[model samples]
Target: MPREHPLLPIVSLPFRRAGRDPMTCRYRCANSCAHPEPNASSTPYFGEILERSLSRRGVARAGALGLLVVGTAASTAGPAAAAPAAPPSGTTSTSGGRPGRPLPFEAVPPNTIDAVVTPPGYQHAVVVKWGDPILPGAPEWDLHRQTAEAQEQQFGYNNDYLAMLPLGTGGRRALLVGNHEYANPELMFPGYTGIPDAAQTAVMFASAGMFVVEIEQVERTGQWRLVRSGQRPYNRRITTTNTVFELTGPAAGSALLRTAADPAGRWVRGTQANCSGGVTPWGTVLSGEENFHFAFVGADEAPESMKPALRRYGFDTANRGGPSAELIDERFDLARHPHEANRFGWIVEVDPFDRASVPRKHTALGRFKHEGAATVISRGGHAVVYSGDDERFEYIYKFVSQGRMDRAKSRAARQRNMTLLASGTLYVAAFDATSAAEIDGSGTLPADGAFNGRGRWIPLASDTTSFVPGMTVAEVLVNTRLAADAVGATKMDRPEDIEPSPVTGKVYCALTNNSRRGADANPPADEVNPRNANRHGHIVEIAEDRGDHTATTFVWSVPVVCGDPQDPSTYFSGYDKSAVSPISCPDNLTFDSTGNLWIATDSAYALGGNDGLFAMPLAGPETGHVKQFLSVPVGAECCGPVISSDGRSCFVAVQHPGEITNSTVENPGSRWPDGDFGKPGIVVTWRPDGRRIGA
Candidate 1:
């Protein structure tokens, strides 16, 4: 259940005839919802403990804090964009993290112990991990009594958001998939058990979820691995306690998704807490069920128009004792099951190359906590996704898809572009301030001098209609954050991982920091999250409209506020923030086929320790320059950075390696690619002569 799933069905879909559709694209927010704080994973997902519990929403420009942003990725490409690949013999994107430098190596530095470092001619490996095997007659990992049928054919646990694809095009083999995102119980339960029977809770429900396998490309030096010897049939794994999902758009079989074993809300079994994902031009793999309210518990027995979105998406209603907060099943006790936590925060997708097909959950892309799903295809080939709801203030979404992307690679064009994410239309963004009354909170640059502006999107449901008014369209896709808080939207900051910009379709999000936006947040410092307690987290950018990747309206800004450029807030676009490379919170992003944006960081110990992977150069002169090529150890969190379409490998994942707090599994804090405990795998990184990691 990587990124869980929902939606109902539709099929005959070949880019179904649609109309203008393509609005919403930001997480929900108007009133409450977004907490973060408590760390050392009891389940917080997303890193540096969500940037030291949401980086204090900082910017308001305290003292001429700096920011003039302008845009461009290959750092001012001059040749109508992405058209300058001729340098090979040695290399050069320019310097390290600013103007013209697509991370020309040399930054790195942040450390902790236990490792996976990089940079300095790059080289990383590990590929297939956690229990390994993955399909083809299973068995192998036997960390003691582990057997949910041998952790369902192996390789699951931690590894977050990845993709790969390839398969044909002589790229040497691909598929890979990934996104296990949860499961560490003292290193996959060995003697470190608080009390777990029922077959070690069914091998901790088969180590959380999502797998796929298939790798290859070994001898090329961009190194891959796994393709385990033979048969392979696409390799599978699903998880959360087996697997079964459907729930398409307009709220599938709504009744808030009937549960007593699928009372027919379309079907739902498990999908674990998958985090981060996306990859679908016409080859499925969306995933996003981020921090699924740590599995269900629904306090206040919901129903009061769904009790303010089940207490603003932080469920787990009572039953709060210990044993690592157990609640095995009672449908996660939401007073005996309250809409199975509305059948999980969705955006599933999956198809990798159809192992046996069937895997959806679209709900027109509403239900929050999604934090992943990138797409971007419209020149009429419809598709356009892009999500982010990794808690705190939530609200950023997008879903277009009324089918349409048959760039034929057949298999009925990958089963009609995998039903283009079930059905579409489901916006949500608002930002309109050139200086909303001169944003106060102070972090400062709004005399129209630019915090940038104009944003729209709105919608709320459409695949069958219900522009949110009084609900229904399955309560606006199962309470999509109270239908973007009854239509006001806006609130962002903790957005986390948005994408789109293979070569400037310009989306790039990662607001990843928002220690409550001050004025006592609930609705504070707007101007599209102008920062108040916002520590170090920024990078907005948008663009849309004429570059219409669906477009409802846009023109955003922010170009990297992230921190440490001698702390006068930090901006990067006007370049010279001492030449970029401090970064913080930014979270996952991708984009290099030439648009260069990489980035990873989920917490930045001020500018010292772990959490790394940065690149930036969205187009010439290092657009909002960033640099650090790779870091990741002492309690990891760099998550699937993907990048490999001949760009020469890059992968990532490494989540929760040696997760922290009391260590465990025999005193382990992080052993990295290996040493012991703390699993979470997949690394890759390349450029050992093959070139192109940061070159």
Candidate 2:
């Protein structure tokens, strides 16, 4: 049975008091501390100042001067203006209804293939994978010759999120940020046991993590390959053992985050099991900490008072020894690092431009089984991020920062903007699906042919205020689940990836799969969920009130009910069911240049085929025109599914390629991307004719 933690605690941290005198340097000294004022002058490069600050105190003269100018300008600009009109909605259409001819290589085979395959006319290749030499002088991987020291320097495992940022002037070189969700010991170890074996455990531990590599585009082939030589300055790795993360935002350094390793509550040892992520307009990567519960053990022995938040985050409350404990750090042992579990579930930000940069865990976003974080510019120019806690009966959340974004992606501007997620307001969703009066346990369309309704933002915390009334801001952000519950937020069906439509300003959330709704204690079906015991979930479209992401009210609708289209309970916005591909357990989502939504599936039920990537024209007559584009090997889930800005290339993460019950490396259930043995990896697909992907 799934564990249910109580809502997180809520406490408020007062903003720093204003300093006396206009010319006094109020900037504090700390590696992860916020600037006293947004306008305080700062050095040209934030990385340089941060490094200097880590070694000593005092602000750089140049930085202070720059801040002065910014502060002066901000003071004159006054408060931010209201949001502009939303962009017109795009047309939804069937896959066959598009005017352009379909690419011959748009779909691929359904097999447990050992190589990266694409449609007939498309090209596919590996961009990067676990243990690939990334940094300078990094030794090549030797499967049997693994070491924690070497693993910390090489690319990590289970690449889930992919983002390529162009480097230099011509865009030939780029930096790649990928998430290492978790390691499959059966595939990663030479000999493995579910039981804890120190040596075997070390190898598995080293492999379970995230990687940041640098690569350049091969001009002739339009393929991307790792830059194996040169400084490759941007290449780095964030693993489970050595990487250090700074805490920021509302819950930063709060009592809940205090641990023996970080009694100051300012830093964490590493980033574990990162999953789907998003890129900020400022050129930074925002990675979600997903499935973090599995990395720890002994939640059952934690102080009784701490169990609620643990249960809310999916930690086993009855058993102190969690799944595969012997393979993980003993700090996970509540007997040791009692507060360790509290450190794993926040959104982590990495600035790829600074190779020596420390990734930060932003606490204002709240903690849960985060799948992905998507950002959009609010009417106030503040950054608004949407996230989902991927669990049955979990909730969807959003964070709006106090600082505005820098529209232009300059180095200095990007540095300033990267701090946007540090301080903000966090909210959970509470919806009222009124369009469907008779939604009753069936996945049927409402009388209006939609599961649409109004909704509220249900504020959890804002800068220094805890909206739960009885809770404090720290408690709200640290133990946010509790605060969300206190306010009666609506429970969702395993909300997975929540992303905003860059073109529409509306947000889309994938409610993956839920088999608990309508259960004795669970909530009954509503228009939005529409079905009790939802198996294959649906897509939710939310239009923020007045198109302002910071608004507390909004309108929502279920645009797509996922399942075999032939199922009467399922509806595809009236599109032809026979023409659409069946999809289940929608896990990750991405949008193409044309605004079509691409969905990747995990755990396809009764589908009788490998999980695959699918695309649908979210707007036109083919709005429900879902088509399978590519499938992963048996037992593997298609994740990431990132389409480049130009739409020329699509990258997907083939996770746990050979995952299977009782499967071992010697007798793998599925060998993929490599014929000998399957190593989960990231695959890049591009059109041979040089046209945009999915065109």
Candidate 3:
């Protein structure tokens, strides 16, 4: 096999425990791993509660298999049967595997190759990339001479979330919306040690936000190309330099959210650290603002009343100076404007169809380092959203709209449905384990032979109502972590992305690695997060009671405890472990039309290779059989991971390619898509024969 970058040398550097290189840790999340875990509250870990509950209930190991409703058919009994053959038309299944089809393509083997390695018969290509011109009148990208103006007009940097919505029939054209998570100047500049002036810092800020570009599907093929030279009216750029977002919900105009720039507390200048996101049922996009705390300064001088909330969100309350963004935008100066930090860290909703529409930050979602917001309408017609706070020992949250969705296909209906997120009841998750006595922080199966249990969604706030004592509705939404801590929400191991299977209505959460688990002063592993010093994170499957997304109660299971197949601690939903590809640090997740779970990884160095995308069937005999479909180049984290509506194409954002400690643009680590200097971008893969992606 030919190497992706046979001429370029692959530099090996020491990485932090999060599996991210030091440079990625610094720029992407402000070296969050280096700081002490922010969740110091005494809320019992999920595993501890599970253990105590089971002790009182007594052991009932036999017939427990009857309770597992995951992908198994009720009539079949025992394990799920093999999926039936695909129909002659070869369309993908959208109902979460009610009529499941078999996985077709053979799995790709793991390797350290510096390229976008795909399965046989599949082809991949770079779509819009960093510095690519999306807006008209934007100058071509120059590697050496980057200007703040040009960066604002061009594609933003380090694209994370991706959403492709069809514009016409047969998927001929669509709008491709991407989230620019953050910027790495060391990889962008020729010799960047640090920002020397405001101009350079402005360029970095302009490169961090979101971009919407129109793309056309290649005639008679599964691939799609960017619409560069046409009447692309939707092509737009949103950056920290100029884009202003509206603050909505109960806390929008509260005194705690007000700042000098916006006395009404209803508007914010921009968004940064826009990580993984989801495409809403109404065709809008929801982007998570993860790690936004890193951009601010003067937290130490902030008022004593706000210090605890700020510190709980990972704001460095000890820091006193040196925030380059404060030079251009005074909002970064938290001491002068302490409430400005509250203006950020909310779930941002954007309309991809309306370029002129102002994006909104929904305070009802309950602010935190949101990993992503995936929505699934409840059986009752209300919109149900699931989000995870992306930090060690944080909690998972859910929001149920007070109003039902207007299903009519009109601009007014869309606008009305968009307001659903603005008024909702926010709830945090509290899990109860069944086999607590069997769990010993060894990642081992319990006496019942499964890591499964019951859980409930603990309500925190609704409109102007607060459920927690001594906190108002505004305090509950803005200072959510403290409220959850007070209410005894279960602590999770860095829950990143929570997505519901459109087919089964079963929610899957990607629990990224937590190195502090079982360490001194930290909680130990439980059934849901069943690993001590967890390097290879696990995936949790949640089934709301009676298959209702609006239900407060649920049953949960850990189907995939990720790691090398050879490791005894690993499990893949009872499938033959030897046949599964090694996966670690599961990050962003999506579903192909066939209801197969598609996972994009970050910090997969635990598996001794580059991070890539993997597909796993949720139903049939192949359930829990993990297979690698594609791998990004060296030093890049696989993100976005939007599968086309037809399931013919898989799009992933290859972020921070060639990023390594002490390597500047002139001397990079990996030359990926271009085989030149490293530039983060989006890549799409599909079979040349036009078959459904990953079979």
Cand. 3 TM to true fold: 0.94
TM-score of each: 0.33, 0.83, 0.94
What digit string (tens of lDDT, one per residue) describes model 3 on residues 618-637? 66788888999898887899
lDDT of 2 by residue, 260-330 (tens): 87897889888776877776656567888877766677777788888877766656678665444434566
Question: Candidate 2 at 314: error in angstroms?
Answer: 2.2
Best by TM-score: 3
Among all windows of 10 consecutive residues in model 3, the one with the lowest summed lDDT is 72-81
Q: In what order do the candidates fall by lDDT, top score first? A: 3, 2, 1
Preferred candidate (lDDT higher): 1 or 2: 2
C-alpha displacement of 676 in model 1, angstroms? Answer: 38
lDDT of 1 at 638: 81
Query: Highest lDDT, which number?
Result: 3
Tens digits of per-residue lDDT for model 1 on 656-677?
7655545567766665565666
State model 2's lDDT.
Answer: 0.66
